[model samples]
Target: MSQDGAEFSFKKIAIPAFGPSILFGLGEGAILPVIALSARGLGASVAIAALVVTLIGIGSLLSNIPASILTDKYGERWSIVGAAGLSMVAMILCAVAPNLWVYGLGVLLIGAASAVFNLARQKYLTEAVPIQYRARALSTLGGVMRIGVFIGPFIGALAINFFQLAGAYWVGVVAVVIAGLVALSMPDLVHEGGAQSATGAPTVRSILVDRRRIFLTIGIGVLLVGAVRASRQAVLPLWAEGLGLDASTTSLIYGLSGAVDMLVFYPAGKVMDRRGRAWVAVPSMLLMGISLLLMPLTTGALGLLLVALLIGFGNGIGSGVVMTLGADYSPARGRAQFLGIWRFLADLGSFSGPALLSGLTAVISLAFGVAATGLIGLAAGAVLWYWIPRSPKTPS
Candidate 1:
C-alpha cells in the first residue's frame, strides 16, 4: 500500500495499539506508591523496605536483553501476552505474600514482566506506524500510559478503603488480565523486508558489536536523560520534606506537576515530526535542569510548586522522544535486540540516578545533591544537542 494509505491504517489499530499500555501503567501506578508500605507491613525495616522498591528496576535491568530475545523470537503480540500473564502472577504473589522476601520477589518479577511488555509494544509500533507519523504515534503511546498512571492512584485509594494495602495488588491483578486480553485481540502486522543473516539469527553479541558506536554516542545521551528524569522523583519529595512540607501538601504538589506533564506530549510529538528530535529534546533537558537548579533555592511551597511545574512541562514535552529515537536508529532485522540494549542503558540511568543522589546527600547536603543532579541534566542537554541528528535517519 501507499505511504499515505499505511499512515491512515494506523487509525484502525489505535485501540489495540495503545489499550494495553494504559492498563499496564494503571497496574504499575496502583502498586508503586504502596510497595514500600506493604513491605513495612510485612516486617521489613526502613532500609529493607526501600530496597524492596528498587527490586523492580533491578528486575527490569537484568531482563532487558532476555526480553528482547523473546520479542524477536515470539513476536510482539505473544510477548505482550506473556508479559501480562507474568504481571498477573506477580501481583497475585504480592497480594498473598507470607513474608517480605516473597513480596520483594513478586515486585522483581513485575519489573521483568514490564520490560517484556514495554519492548514488545515499542517494537510493534516501530514497525507498524509510518515514518512520518512515528513521533506522534509513540508520543501518544507515552501520553496514554501517563494518563493511566495519573488516574490509577485514585482507583487504588478507593480499593484501599475496602481491601486495605493489599487492595492495590488486587487492582494490579485485574488490570493486567484486561491488558493481556487486549493484547490477545491485537492484529499482527507483517514486518517489512530487511537483511537477514545467511548463517542464521544474529547473536546479541554481534548486534551490540555492530551497533556499538550508536550505543556509545546517542546511548550515552539516553543514559543521562534517564538519570535526570529519575532524579526528579527523588528531588521533589526529599526537598519538600527538607522544607518542612507535610505528606498531603507534597502529594498535592506532585499531582499538580503530573497534570502539567500530561498536557504537552502531543504538541511536542507534532513538533518532533515536523521539526526534529533536538527541537524538543534539547529544550526539555535544559528546562528540567534549570528547574532542578532552582529547586535548591526554594524556601516555600509556592516556589517548589512552580519549579515542579517547569520540570513537569519539560519532561512531558520530551515524552516518547527516547522511544522515537530508538525506532529511528534500529535496524529492521534486529530492531528488538537493539532496543533491548537501548532500554538497558536508559534503565541503568534510572536505577543509578537515585542511588547517586543518596550518595551525594550522604556526603554533602540535600541541596548539593540536587544541584549535582541538575548538572547531569545540563550535560544531557548538551550531549543530545550535539549528537541528535538534525534529521531523523529512518533505518531500512
Candidate 2:
C-alpha cells in the first residue's frame, strides 16, 4: 500500500476496526450515568459516591502502562478480547455486589479493562490503516464510539424500566460480551515494521527515554486539549444548574450538544488527511475556547445551548486528532509503548481539568474558574499551531 492509504476501502475493515468499539462504548455509556447512584444504593454518602466515580479514571490512569505492555506482548486482538472479558466480569460483579467496596472494585476493573481495550484497538488501527486514510479511519472509530454512547442511555433506560438500576449493568454485560466476540472474529493484519530492539523488545521505560522530546513538546498541547475537552462536561452542567435549570433541561442541552459533536468527525478527518493536522486541531481548540469563554455570560437556555453547540462542534472536529498524532509520531519499534505514554498524558490532563476547576471555583467564583479553563484552551491552540507538524510523520 502507498503511504497515502491508496486503494484502501474503509468498508473492508469496518467490522474489525469499528464494531467492537461501538459495543464497548455502549457498555461504558450504559454504566457511566449510574455509577454514583449505584454506590449510593450500596450505602455510600454523596461525597463517597462521587469519589467512587473518580475511581474509574484512577484505574485507567494506573493501568495505562500495564495495558501498553499487554498490548505489546500479546498484540491487539487478544488484548481486546481479554479486556472485554474483564469488562464482563466487572459488570457482573457490579450487578451483584453486596456493598460499595465490591462495587467500587468492579468500577475500577471496568476502567482498567477500558484502558487495555482502547489501547489495543488504537494500536491495531495504527498498524493496519494506511497513512493517508489514517485520520479518516481513526475519526470514524471515534465517531462510532460517540454514536454508541449517544444511543446507549436510551437502551439503558429501556432496560431500567424492566429491571431497575441493575439493568444498566446488565446492558453493559451484554455489550461487552458481543464486543469480545467481534474481536475474536477479527482477522489479524500484518504490522509493517518489525521490532527495533537489537537485544530484545524495548521496555516502556526505554521507549519513554527515546521519545522524550515528542512527549515534552507536542504532548503538552495534547494534554491541554484533553483538559479543555473533559472540562466541558463539568462546565456545562454546573453552569446550567447555576442558572437554575432543572436536571432534565440540562440533560436535553447536553444531548443536543452531543448530537452536534457526532456530526463532524468524518469531515474533520478528511480535512486533516488532505490538508494537515493543524487545520483541524488549531480551529478545534479555538472554537472550544471561545465557546467556553462565552459560557459564563449565558443566563438563559438559548444562550447556553448556542455556546454548548459551538463547543460540541469544536470538539467534534477534533475527533481522533490525538490518536492520529500519536500514531504519526509512534516508532514502529515500540509503537504500543509510545501510545501508552501518550494516552497517559492525555488522561492525566482529563483528571486535572476537573480538579483545577474545583480549586479555582473554591478560591474565586465559578465564572472565573470556567473562563480560566477557556484560557487553557486558547493556550493549547497556540501550542498546537506552533508545534504540530505541517505533514504527518510516517512512523519510523
Once superposed on the true structure, which residue ranges of model 1 sit more than 4 Å away at CA?
1-9, 193-199
lDDT of 1 at 64: 95
Q: When superposed on Cα atoms, how far off is each prediction in RMSD?
A: 1.5, 1.4
lDDT of each candidate versus the true structure: 0.91, 0.91
Give the TM-scores of the predictions, in the order they appear.
0.97, 0.97
lDDT of 2 at 364: 100
- Give the clashing pairs for model 2: none
lDDT tens per residue, model 2, 312-341? 999999999999999889888788899999
Residues 1-396, model 1: lDDT tens digits: 114534366667787889999999999999998999999999999999999999999999999999999998899999999999999999999999999888989999999999999999998888777788888889989999999888888899899999999899899999999999999888887765434655467667878999999899989999999999988998999999999999999999999999999999999998998888999989999999999999999999999999999999999999999999988888877888999999999999999899999999999999999999999999999999999978756555
Clashing pairs in 1: none
TM-score of 2: 0.97
